[model samples]
Target: MKTILVIEDDIGIQKQLKWSLSEFELVFAQDRQSALTQLRRYEPDVVTLDLGLPPDEANATEGLACLNDILNFNPNCKVIVITGNTDNSHALKAIALGAYDYYQKPIDADVLNVTLNRAFKLAQLEAENRALRSSNVAAQEIIGNSDAMIKACRTVEKIAPTEITTLLLGESGTGKEVFARAIHKQSPRVKKPFVAINCASIPENLLESELFGYERGAFTGANKTTLGKIECANGGTLLLDEIGDMPLSLQAKMLRFLQERVIERIGGRQEIEVDVRVICATHRNLSEMVAEQSFREDLYYRISEITLVIPPLRDRGHDIIVIAKALLHRFNDEFNSKIQGFSDCAMQAMMQHSWPGNIRELQNKLKSAVILADSKQISAEDLGLTAQSSKTATLRMVREQAESQAIRHAHSLASGNLSKTADILGVTRPTLYALIEKYKLLDLRTTESETQQ
Candidate 1:
């Protein structure tokens, strides 16, 4: 059973509340000292505080102290403060001090019950969200520090605040969906739901209704009113994955919604207003599509207001190795493998091979390797990559490969901190600086600062 602590100085009111709140595992304290003691003992999920306690029965000071103490102990706990009927100022102050809400004196039982119910519901949701976050997959997390990746991160941080339509352009396997989510998570609507739909996955006949929704009896299969993905993502984000494949007919309706912020569900007479951020991702060349009339010229302009190009895995230089190791650690936990790390030959082979499918391919291969490898260290054979037959020991190729591997590993171990990168490479801070100078790593590092109009 969930616990509640009631802190009030009035004996008569306490008895009345105790009877009313008998459904809860309730504990009471008549003063600040006793309240603190009870808080430690019960660690209750909710607290009902009357901001008029001993020594300041007419003031909010004593009650405010208890409120602060409760928050200090458990920031997740919901504290509801009771205040004078006409005084909204003290209630607002309690809110600023982290109280969940305030109830006026001479409290109506119905109103207070509603407020308590809402607070409890909020507490439960917060707990569930925390648990879910802790258990989420690491591959789902962004794990690259290459210049291309950093630039992508910076772009997301900037564009997430605006209502502009965003288009993420990338190769087939580069992580456009991940970047889209990062934008949503950083945006003002982060607290709301984020719904993702792949345009290429749905059949042409069903895509329209899937997005704009349908009315009851609208079609042969429609038995009930349904909210579409757009409506479901109200006040949040909607990721249109493989948006290049969105049917031409639906593109017109999508463009209407983008231009007007309203949608008329299929067979529905009234238009529905929705506030949603649209993030579109595709591997296709949309400009080329516009030239060919395959995609609407107007829709292309709208979605490309802020376009981000995610570099392919081979082009991202050292990021491939950084991403590979991250995938390895994730699979290790999931497959219950005793794999400690990658062997020298495995690392060499990973650096040599070109990643055709980018991060997605790397993750899949690592997941497979972790389950199949028999030894502690993963080797080249385990990764399913073999060294080339015409192996050249040219100094240029060897140094270039070593330098690329060093940059990737340093960034990974340092979590993208440049100063840490210098330290980990075992070169003097200035020597490491000169190496970054002698090599063209600066372009990779500085590319993150670029912004789109």
Candidate 2:
């Protein structure tokens, strides 16, 4: 339970508060000195300061002084000033002095509890933001705690120490390069240079030269003998991003280099040996490309000696919120904005969106929102999301969609086991079959038949 420090001088009022706010662990103080002492002891996130204390109970002098003291001690603490019903002037002054809110003399238990709950929530959000800021200083590590992410990270840990040519398979904006850098950071060649080249972004003609370098006379305008990415990262790690986009003509040479650990620069006949760890990443399905005869099968097998598949943001569950908050904190510092956090609508929109562009899209949306947001909280509109449109979806449609998704997820987890799927969904096998049929999940039925076989 959350702790609340109540600084009130009236004995009867304190007893009434204690009885009403029994849900919280209450710390009582009749004066400023004891209030400060209790504050230091409990370090509660929230404090209720009655603007009527022992020495100056008739006036707001001592209570205001205590408010300043509390604020000075812990700036993040939410201090709700308790004042007389007609003392609007002192309440406004207390607010100006950084009090979270004010409660009048006639305090209703229900109303005070509501204010206290809000204060506690705000305090928690601020604390979480501070923690996220501290933890993401480097901003290079992978950020997710989902089972898929945990499993992928464990795989990276196991493979990083070895000199294996690993392949990272994932959708775009899924932080494939980040994982590559993580592997490089964990490996023996961490002190050496780490290089990355996007095969898809570079022209086919220039990609080979970029990877293996070119002699001065190899091509026109070739600056005096330049070292390529492979040679530049001789003793380090080289990330071949979007390797599936590399021209099929160059695949043979890539395969040869991978097999021999050597390369021949353009217009250079002699072979040059290079000691480097190679990591390849692509959003494309290389196996499918290999079957289509576009990507070389040998090269795919060679590079994918070890492969790690990164999970998409949508599948990561609460990690989306964790990542979104981390990004918010980072952008707040970058843009020097005091945007507190996301609004309820903004959070709901985020959770509902599929995140097709993943973290990159999230970062862009947040950066824009932080720069343009006028309010303390980022609303769905500020994030360029339409939470209202989702409300237009009929209740029946929403329920059916949710049910279909749950059944599909449970079916996947159970690996086509009808009984196991039913158990996971907390339904009978017949009910599961009925729902699957109603949802027209033909693939699942086929999988069930295959499993039975």
Q: Using lDDT, give the best candidate's number.
A: 2
As a TM-score, model 2 comes out at 0.68
Superposition error at 316 for model 2 (Å) = 1.9
* Per-residue lDDT of model 1, residues 1-453, tens digit only: 668899988888888777776667778998899999999999888899999888898888898888888888897899999876486877777775668778887867656776787789767755643453343322235665556666666677678889888999998888888888878877888899899999999999999999999999999989999999999999999999999999888888899999999999899999899999999999999999999999999999988888999898888765666667667767878877767566657767887788898888888778888888887677789889986643454445666779977976786677666667778887676776677777767743553233111
TM-scores vs. true structure, each candidate: 0.57, 0.68
List pairs with backbone clashes in candidate 2: none
Regions of model 1 farther than 4 Å from truth: 1-140, 389-453
- List, residue by residue over 335-387, the lDDT tens digit for candidate 2: 88877667657877898889999999999999999999877678899999976
Residue 374 of model 1, lDDT score = 80
Relative to the true structure, how large is the alpha-carbon lDDT of every model? 0.80, 0.87
